[model samples]
Target: MKILTIQQIIKNIENEVVFEAYAEDESFKIKIDEYIPYVCAAIHDGGQMRDDVLEKCSLSTYERWYEEDPHTAEFVGNFPILIQGCDSRFEYDLNRDPDNAIYEEAWGKNVWETPLSESQKQRSLAKHHAFYEVVEALIQKLESKFKKCVVYDIHSYNWKRWDRPVPVFNIGAELVDHQKFGDYVESWRDGLSLIELGDIHNYTAVNDVFYGRGYLLGFITNKFKDTLVLATEVSKIYCDELTGESFPEVINQIKEGFKTAILNHAFEFIKNETSYKVSKQVNILHNELESDLIKIDKQLYSLVKDFELLSVINPINLEFEKKKFLASNYKYEPQFKYNPLNIDPFEFKRKLSNIKVEKINDISIQNMYVDTINAYFDKVDLLANLGTNKFLYNSLRYFGEPSKKDVDNANFVLYCPEFRMEKEGEFNENEVVELFKNATQDYGFQFDIEVSDHIASKALVINSKKKVVIKKGVKFDKRFTKGLIEHEIGVHMVTTMNALKQPLKIFSIGLPVNTLTQEGLAILSEYYSDSINHDRLRELGLRVLAVNMLTSGKSFNETFLTLMEEYKMAPENAFYLTTRVYRGGGFTKDALYLKGLKTILNYIDQGKKLDNLLIGKTSVEYVDTIDELVDRKMINSPQYFTKIFKKHLEKPEINPILQYIFNGIKD
Candidate 1:
């Protein structure tokens, strides 16, 4: 490949820049080589206005920037043979016909305060003429080497101004001979539609937002009979148009993703192109199965919600010693006596395994969908066995305990004790209700809260159902309100609302492996709200140690003694910690808070986007998989976002003291 200078880059361009031949101009950066059979050009990317026009133009630099293609260069960056204009379109728009190159009025407003003199007009037209001269040379070079050549004329549009969801990409073919290349064009759109940028889906269409009627496409098609130009218009969904800043990741994703797909389609076109189709029924079936899964979630969680607290707290005011002994001796059995499993896991698994994955666009992805659903059903079976020895055995099978790394990470908690001044105050339930109502309004979330005797915890949170049942007679502390809202509503309820925006029910309920991520995100939300206090951290630390003891087969008395004596926790608080782990057949779920906090904090430090975590019960483990679903438009972005943690900021360094407190396990 060679880079050439514009003066030196006439029709028969040649350059002697070492590794190859080339003359170069900033206005035109073309990577040309031995008959590559195609060229990718972005003609509207320039925004430099000539000094002469500076006095004559009425628009501001930003105004012209708003109309310019900011990242078209990134989209076509990787092509071996490329041609892109570098001058501002305000100087001359190569895509427009020669006479219209310098706009008299652009879009709707007057572009210039005064019309350009003949010399200035000729100057702009001369550059336009020079661009086509090289384009024709490049085309001729390709046509002589191969029988035909194809051009991908790339540009972007402002889609947000439109009233509806438009295609992420639009291929304009008005100027192309669709009679010969229509199938190839549609195939290209289909493949582009499958391209993804993180969790954002790529929706592509043909002749939708723009028909390929640009002068560049017309000139090439009319002059070169065998040459085809696909006028591709991608919406600036890949960037914040208002800010004039582009997402490099998205730019890279498309630049790399489409490079090969475009080449593959072209090669196929060169060899009798065929068409591909996607099944509409598979999407319907996915929706139907999701409905079935939603029913299973209600049954599973309702029974297990307060099982840990209720079963462990003896109603009778027993002696302190007796309570301590009973805490360890707490025995549980199958709970089908009250809450029966509505959907049998075994049958549910059978149904999911029977799905015809081959019908989906990507079979492996479809299989993952099945596996994730089956995982939820597995949890349902485990929930059915809650309070029994059977539940403990099954809990091990589904939700495993924190590993050594998880324990080790918990010790590094952030030490901002002085920052927790709000913890000193107290408030009543009415205050709590008002506070929650105010917090919800920040994100525009809708829900109801009430005080109730049937509730166990001070705040019995049922976020997925948008309900927070406050235990009657318990005075609510004002300090707990914000953090609790951040935890329960910001993280949990916000995700529930976000899930509703998605097409699948799994997001609405939970991803089966969601326990760790869900709790972790909840705790993280508390921290983001600045409501995290040492007391809350200590409570989480105690739960971690308690769960570790249970998983290691320590009796409740052993765990209780460790919390009370070694950790110096009060007797009542120690009992609460013991039961939290030993309930639900040795539930190891509580350990996740510290584990989740550390993991999520590390993820942010490593520069990962956290929005993926908010998309309806998504686990950090399945982010890539969930992203693929989101890219397919099978899921939607979070509709409800947390104001507390609007976006992840730079993470503070891990606190070794806090880390030691949580992740430490004495052998």
Candidate 2:
């Protein structure tokens, strides 16, 4: 427990003696003895939040510790190389990517009063990078010294939170090539399962609650071929979780038991036949390619966003650019390098045709990632191109649009005029915000409600800092209250907040091609809550029809008349729906509302899980990609869900007869 710098720790490890050193502010600590071939790490064991960050957090200290794996380092204290984090994961999760190490929400409670500014996030990310720099140096030294090494990446989990009984031990092998290290992983689990202290039945299993798909394990596996790192989580059977107290006997039993188990696995690893070591150059190339794709994604999203800004700056200029750009075949300067996969030319063309899904080694996962990201990039490009052109954008969006036949098969449409809710009474914007606040409060999400004059379209929208913004003159239509709650808070904001907790900035900022899925899922939430109304369904249908008109070269005025004269919508509602379709000189994304609704209904008809829809700012189409990342342990299932769904489902009388019936408004 010596207070020292990373430089000092790296320098002293060669001494072949037990010593410990603390990296900056004592937030992360490491110890080494002689030149051991194995290291132990407790990357998520910390519960300390910086004073600056703590002042802004909504969570109590007890809540943070409950999620943090306590006493992870102590289990392997005797190991020669031991590294563990001391700062609370709420401050920065060492196991996540540095890009999204800081969280906007943790377990659904707003983790910060406001999202940290660039400087504040930079401080935390800088610290994260420093910790990894030391790790890179440490592993490099070990592999150089031992020619091959093993690392026991230690962690813990709360078994009580799980609905079903899980084994006492979980081994994550999602990232590791099992064919190469499967024997060692299995042997470790078998040895630990048999550990006996006072109670003798501590069970162990592999790939239970956690798969060794954490960033630390992934980074080590990718960077160092000779090093086999094991990501392990022990259920909180060794302590009092509510109080973060360890039972002395249980702790000692684990320390002694895992010590034996780890050493045995290490020895076995050294002599294991059929090494699956990949070249260092390949590792470097994969990392570089991944970074480049992310960089391009960031550039594309950041530069192309702000539809409001574009429309406001100079509508005249925008119109001019739109017309001029259309004359040039509606092509604007490319936002990023056009090599969608960011791979070499030949491989890039090949990937477009051959989409493979496998995870045999780093290579297989790398190929899968390439394909996934490329698909996302195309979606993103479509989204970006939407507002820039009416004719061209409509042409592409029309492909995703549901035809009349597909619309006929819509499973749920709020079409019964008999239950018109306008006479039921409406609430003002303040009351609507109050309802939102009450729902979020029940779920432990803390955020502020403010009247905003700056927003363009949202009657209300949740900002990045978790603040709910209401437009100045917005009123809550009685018909829309329940639907808006489930759509925005349950789907949109839930995904936004959950994405902040993930390691990928793409999830927090925006997912590749996620708009359709997000909107579709929001519609699902509205349907599930039984808040769907004829007016809302008609509005959605008109948006699709409006976009169709645009694709067919109809002017904005013509689309507006179709909704008002043909659909008989009121002037105001027609204005909002039509304007949404024509906002950015003929934006076509509104088509997704109708298209996505059909997609989700089809998804439900096929008996697919809906909870995964809440996993970050994700699309239902990218469900497989999300699954791979989860199986790889890159992300977790959404921590917060609309509990209202459970409550709504409990009503036996509310049997929804599956049929979409929309009585067309008379001309």
Candidate 3:
């Protein structure tokens, strides 16, 4: 959190232009943390080479040359040392691309002139290659631990050509993957407040301006595509034009902006695997359901042609065991075990569609909230009744009065109903829904309100047409509605709509085993300002706390009691809410908060592009088993909603802490 300091950052840069430390602070530690031994090694090598080059002239002559405006001398002095331990040839030329003997803009000089000077050539190869070789080795080592790696080949460029005018910052002129590098570079632009001067200095790779083909880029790209090489070329504005004098102000600014950019990308790159893993897992699960319903069962037809599913042919028992293991683990987690009702895993496993059911309560809220529960159940039943073979829904009838177990298993339950007397007149339930629709169009989502006379508890469900069923008299507070909209419409409905658009209804029916990312994505939708409010943030925070509690093995009763007695939540409210946190015993609510936060933050960091999170464009671990199917085109993109939500997604800048967490590789 401390402001930028010099030593911490300069020590990390291959060439500092000048070696002077100014101001010590925490930001320095963060910057220094990103400097692996590479900076030291590169500088050390460059130093040694400088001495060797200077050996040709006398000490007096060298000192006098240096005295004539020492910044260039300082740079030359540090250069050899920086690259000391590297292979001056086979590895990286530092000044030129490794594959070429001459720079791309060497003014047509035959830079590789000494055909007979094998010794000189070998020395160049040995010295230059050593630096790049060490770089390559370091990259490989880093890649083993991370999903990607980055190489910041630091250098300074004179903006004013002898024959031309000076330009602004020269971002490695061209051949760079703009899509992959744009975000990070943009971060630099923001951090530095640099003005755009058109594309004057933005030459593509190997153009007339300072082109070097066989440099670090060649070595880096050849071995690893994931390894990003940034050849930063700072202008000579910091040096005296006539005498090449040094200016501390310019140096400080470049160091600050440079450090920010590197640290930012480094953090994201390191955490990339975890996020991608979770996303991929979700994708796999999504694709699998589509495949099972459309390809195997042949009950649903594809609405989109490219939708494909990747199937894993594990033995049936193994699949069952895996599912059971997850369920058991979920149930045993501290937050999940707080429920009082019994969950029948048998009933859950017996039903093969993507839906899961848990018995939430025993106090006869079943018949008590029949009006609400019945409508939800019947709507799901209607879908099943409609000849959809791939998607299935199971119900967990509450066996006991609300308990920790019950709350954990069910999404939400209606407290004993508080009847709201219509201001004056009574209307039919269907008519009421139409009225509500007209009233809330300014909001979003169309609700299919069904007042159930037979039900005591209020529950919610979404049908294929995207109509939501809520028991009448359920308190329509901001929390309930926001959570409902985010979970149902954003995730379930959108995914369903996309699936339906697929040439096959199987994808439309539902996705299997996609709980993690599905739930993560669903919960993330609640954070948007358009949908979320103070009440929603509170609910989400509690959910996160619940996940932490459940994973620590808190029982359902304990969790319920804790929420009510300790957190001072209302008894009925606490009991009902605790059930959700404690369900699946542990795994149920555990995912909604932390995992959801991570997913949402990542989406923002990636610029709020929902295409990846929604259209299944994510990694296997972070997603479901269905990714393979989507990859294979077994599942198709949703035509109606994908584009609509795409613009709303915004990738936010990576936070420094998370970036610090991911600094391992970039360092």
Tens-digit lDDT track for model 3 on 1-667?
Answer: 3433333333334332322221231100111222221221222122222333334322233222222222222221111122222122111245565445413223333222223244544555554554444455555644554556555554555544547653344446354555776565444434334432232242222223443243566667678767665554445665655454667555434443443344444444434522233222212111222222324223222221222211001111322332443456334322211112122333422332322111211111111222222333432332232212221122112111223432332222112122222333334445544544553353344445455422212333343434555444445554345445455555555565555445534334333324445665665554342344333434444555555455456666666666666656665555445545433322232333434445455655654435534652222133322333446454564443432244344543433432332222110
- In candidate 1, which residue ranges exceed 4 Å CA deviation? 1-358, 411-423, 452-460, 472-477, 631-634, 647-667
What is the TM-score of candidate 3? 0.33
lDDT agreement with native, every candidate: 0.65, 0.64, 0.38
Which segments of model 3 are wrong by more than 4 Å?
1-294, 297-459, 463-467, 478-487, 504-506, 509-513, 547-553, 582-587, 612-635, 642-667
**Cα lDDT tens digits for candidate 1, 326-426:** 46553322121223345555665565555543233232243345556566556665666755778777666677786776555444342323334454677
- Scored against the true structure, residue 432 in model 3 reaches a CA lDDT of 44
Of 1 and 3, which scores higher on lDDT?
1
| TM-score of candidate 2 on Cα atoms, chains taken together | 0.46
TM-score of each: 0.50, 0.46, 0.33
Q: Determine which window of 10 residues in candidate 3 has minimal summed lDDT.
A: 307-316
Candidates ranked by lDDT, best first? 1, 2, 3
Error of 2 at 78 (Å): 32
Compare the candidates by TM-score and give the number of the best one.
Answer: 1
Q: Score candidate 1 by TM-score against the native.
A: 0.50
Q: What is residue 150's positional error in candidate 3, in angstroms?
A: 34
